[model samples]
Target chain A: MKYSILASTLLLAGGVAVLSGCSQVQEPAGICNMSAIAAQRQLAAAPSRVQGGESPLLEMPLNSVSITDYSVINKLYVRTVNARRTPTGTVEVYAQIINCTDFPLNAEARTQFYDAGQAPSEPISAWKRFNLPARTSNTYQTQSIGTQSAAFYMVELRETK
Target chain B: MRRARALPLLVLASAFSLSACQTVQNTAGTPTQYLDPGSSGVVRGVGIEGQDIRSMSDEMMRDLLTVPALANASISPNVIVDAEYFQNESSSRINKNIITDRLRVDLNRASRGRMQFVGRQYADMVQSERNLNQAGVVSGGTIARTAGQLAGDYRLGGRITSIDARDPRSGMIERTHQITFEMVNLQNGQIIWSNYYDLRKAAQDDIIYR
Candidate 1:
């Protein structure tokens, strides 16, 4: 009887030990690291030259020209002289057109003048359209009219509608 | 009385033996929560290849585009970019084309500028023509100038440098990536803007583990 009682007690104790080993808990998945993304966004928001500066052409005489009954579109001015000549005459007159808001300005938009006059009386000269490069500036010269040169020449700036 | 006394002693001895047996059996079975405490797994080496370096560099380039120098430019401006020169001083090998392509895409998206492929394409064509001449194929450079040429007022150029080193005590590895981008006046070659970014990552294991 005593031996049987001992065997029962041992069996109970073994069952308890086995059951205790079965209880366990697991952890969940972790979050992804986003430090890189945050850093990139901060960099994007940092100030740059384009955002802080005024228009590069604001100080030039061209800025003084009034847009009278004319819409301002795209504008480009380039200074090119006949380098072959000894006393290089800086051709200052640039082509101007009244309406360019509807279409893109091309090389054909430059105006040509034969003589110094408001009206196109004789087709002695032709104006050629110019395109400006990004992040750079171009300078255009005005026609030299004897001793009294026009302070400013009008160039049509094309606007893309 | 003797039987009663022996009964408790026998029960105690049996209980001790049973607990020991259960402990051994529990250890032999599959562990539910914990890994094997006695196993010291083999430490593996990390392998960073040329492509991995290129990928990391590309990602860094994309991140760098957010810098104001490239971001503040008007979207419709013309842009020209010279091919990047890759000079590798580190022990790791990397592809130059990967860096160039990344820069191209990043700048294009950031500035809304058009790229003129003519200069590089022309140079390539001329070089190829020369090669063809040596091989006896007669060809002249007759490509007409197209209106869509990437002739921007500004030109962007830059370089990439990388460094990788291992820690002696902890055995941790670190990688450093650096890139510098500069925008210059196309006509005058004057640098108008410049910026650079550096990125570093440290990993406990040199190699990625699954």
Candidate 2:
């Protein structure tokens, strides 16, 4: 009887170990604490939310400038971004980009506007190209064209491709 | 000796036949991809492109909205946008309708009743329907018929011009395109609003724009 009980106990232990291993694999270790790169990818991969849909877990701040190309990050940076409504109620965004490198640089940028609820308000703006002299600042300006109120905006920049 | 010669000929024929039976690579061609119309597409040239048309029209549309006499007027002014007066003097071959059509459509949607657009291009069709209604061939519409078609207060007219330079030795070409957009007061013939877009591009060779 003791030998039989020992065998039964060993089998149970083996089964428990296999189940626990699976549980560990499926436990979602980094879900609550995602790295910055992973979080960025998640935010970009997620589709734009509808008007009343659930908000994204990660979102870039409103009226912010994002340098999407890492290669351009060290070469240039946005100095200031100003967004305000024009007299006609359209949202206008202006940004100043400063080139840090000693050589002249060409960069492109586009803007996406959002409504008060953080839903995209208008079609994204066309990519505007600008040339920056060495160690100089260049201004970039764009406005949203829609009847919908544009309460927020984000600008993305990359090296001219 | 004849059997030996026949064996050699058969071997040579078999070698040729075997070479003919070789397998081909059978590679696949590139799949089609959708690109944003507002961004630079894969095919580019030293002339005005689709992105240029979109960007320029968008910019002008926003500018037109900011004018007090147009968008925020007490009574929305009737505006007619068509390719009738818009001219293209550039070397690049582009359908002029592409620019005017986009501008009118986008402006009409964004205006949202703040401005009115007259269907001047469909005047003949509208006139035919009106004649039918009057002749009793078709029943009168539920709404009351007006005595005359709507008249436009403002009309859009523009011109596209370009300058081209070519290098003799390097075979390089440079092109500069200047497109001007203007809204004219139909009654006074005064240009109430005007804007222009300019771009310069240099390239060695480019794909044909069709």
Candidate 3:
């Protein structure tokens, strides 16, 4: 009777130990360390060709980098890009960010402007912050002072903890 | 004697088991790390912050770039920007120059000679230099000699005003700020380009705005 009781108690303890490990499985999802960067290239206006031709946007690239947070993937993304070169030979760009989350998020972003030679342009923009309300988005607009030198650009977003 | 030895061993075994339980259960303390302000600055009660300054100036720069008066073939219009016109009529006691300086410096860099800025704040130094040059104490470099100080084509001016209301029960303070920026054409005395940025902040009196 003693051996039987001890065996049953040991089995009960083993079962409790197995059940306790399940909570750890859920925690491995862990805290979100996810962020995304979007890049856009400014194309010269095609004055001769009709506007209905191949969109300059198709030539522009949408790059996703260092994505780890799957939970917030649908929560935010680059909506569109509008870019133009000024008569003064400088470039102006507007990057729209959309937030699909149900809560407000303070998103931060920075941009790198590059020359035609693929060399980084001077005075790379500092990281700028934006406040996004739930289910809404906003445009972050900036420009390259060296419009003649700027041929490419990249916009980066980071998990602003 | 045997009972005493057994008791010590039992206590040591219990200690090891308890430590194992603690190791398994102590996963709650996730540590925090510091982040750069340019990347992720700390946020306080909804107030004007470094992030706000960056975003505000960036938006203003973009808008100015769109307006021909500031960014087109208008080869560098001489302009004046100062805190006197960019007043803080809001409850927040922020330095008004912070806004104007950022806008001016960033625009100057990004405008690519499309916009020129004059420092009315340093008129004294300019007058001193011109006076010395006129007196022949110091020779003036030849560009195009002018009779007097160069006049600005447009004067960048605006006001930062606010409206404050209180929640009766919670006593929480909700403050709204309307920051307006305009570039007035000096010749015609008309506001050529004008826009306003708005922000609303609410919190208790204990919060600091800086």
Candidate 4:
């Protein structure tokens, strides 16, 4: 009776392990925490929230709007960013992202240009990818394709697989 | 009674096997998903892929639109994208037309009247139609006709070239492709704006590019 019970217990344990393995996504050790990356990305995109001072999104009220991002990239911090209206009247954006983690992270971001009236431009910008070295800063930039049509802009960032 | 008892056991075995079988003749499984063409393609080879084409064209278009002269010029620049001037000097077999077409089409759509595309290659058909209309054989086009076709202010052309290296031991091959784009002033024959995009990729040369 004990032998049969032991065999049945072993079988149950193996099945449990297999089931767990199937559901869990395998990522490199020590860098799999997506929540931390999400935080950083959100922080990098926070500059769009600043109203009236420097950002080209002149239509939005100060401190009332923030760039929306993937929930997990909230940790990506913005070192410095410059946003302005160019000679062509389109919004131009340049941003520096600081990676606080111990390992390199591959990330992608895209910006959507909107008219002052909060209307989104047709066909969102392509997702541009960049590599951030551990404890280093990476720069990303984009210009609106439509000249007079772009007044306000919002950027989204996420960790790329 | 004996036969009845054997029949139940046989039925039980068949039912158990059917329930446990992994392969079924006709049943629904996972529905297929799609991949973005700009980044990925159905075919994978040692040579260039869809991502390269998309990235190069996108970069070229972005840079081309940002040029100040195109808009600042006194007259709206008439742009032409002809295969004759755009040469493919690379070792790989690629459809160079795809690159030029994407750039021209996207730029034309987004330029907002700042630039105009001249279909010079289709001039023969246009000329033929013009003659027919002027001769009163056919009704004239809705727009008024000019004495002659408009000349292009700027001509667009480029070249696709490559450099390659190989490791004999590991049989790894690396190739770097350089795609250069330029807009030249039609009258002065001077290059107004020039840009080059290059990428180096290494992979085992197991499959052919074509």
Clashes of each: 16, 0, 1, 14
Q: Number of the top candidate by lDDT?
A: 2
The alpha-carbon lDDT assigned to residue A73 of candidate 4 equals 40
Displacement of residue B154 (Cα, Å) in model 4 is 0.7
* DockQ for each numbered candidate: 0.01, 0.33, 0.22, 0.17
Report the TM-score for the A-chain of model 1.
0.24
TM-score of chain B of each: 0.45, 0.89, 0.74, 0.79
Model 1: per-residue Cα lDDT at residue A100: 19
Given candidate 1, what's the lDDT at residue B130? 66
Q: If both were scored by lDDT, which would come out higher, candidate 2 or candidate 4?
A: 2
| Candidate 2 Cα outliers beyond 4 Å, as residue runs | A1-59, A146-148, B1-19, B22-28
Candidate 4 chain A lDDT trough over 10 residues, lowest sum:
A58-67
Docking class of 1: incorrect
Among residues 3 or more apart in sequence or in different chains, the pairs in candidate 3 whose N, CA or C atoms overlap within 3 Å are A90-A147
TM-score of each: 0.31, 0.78, 0.64, 0.68
Report clash pairs, candidate 2. Answer: none
User: What lDDT score belongs to each candidate, Candidate 1 first?
Assistant: 0.42, 0.83, 0.70, 0.71
lDDT per residue for candidate 4 within B73-145, as digits (tens), equals 4567888866658899988898777787877877787776878888887899989998898899998368987
Q: What is the per-residue lDDT of model 3 for residues B140-196, given as tens digits with 9 covering 90 to 100?
A: 577665788878888888888888888888889888888899988889989988888
Please give the C-alpha DockQ score of model 4: 0.17
Cα deviation of A22, candidate 2, in Å? 70
Please write out the lDDT profile of model 1 over residues B1-210, one tens digit for every residue: 999999999999999999887744445675566522211124433333333333343333333333333343344334455454334444444455555565565445433332322245365676665677657786455775343434566666766666878889998887776666666767788876665545455667756433
Which of 1 and 4 is ahead in TM-score? 4
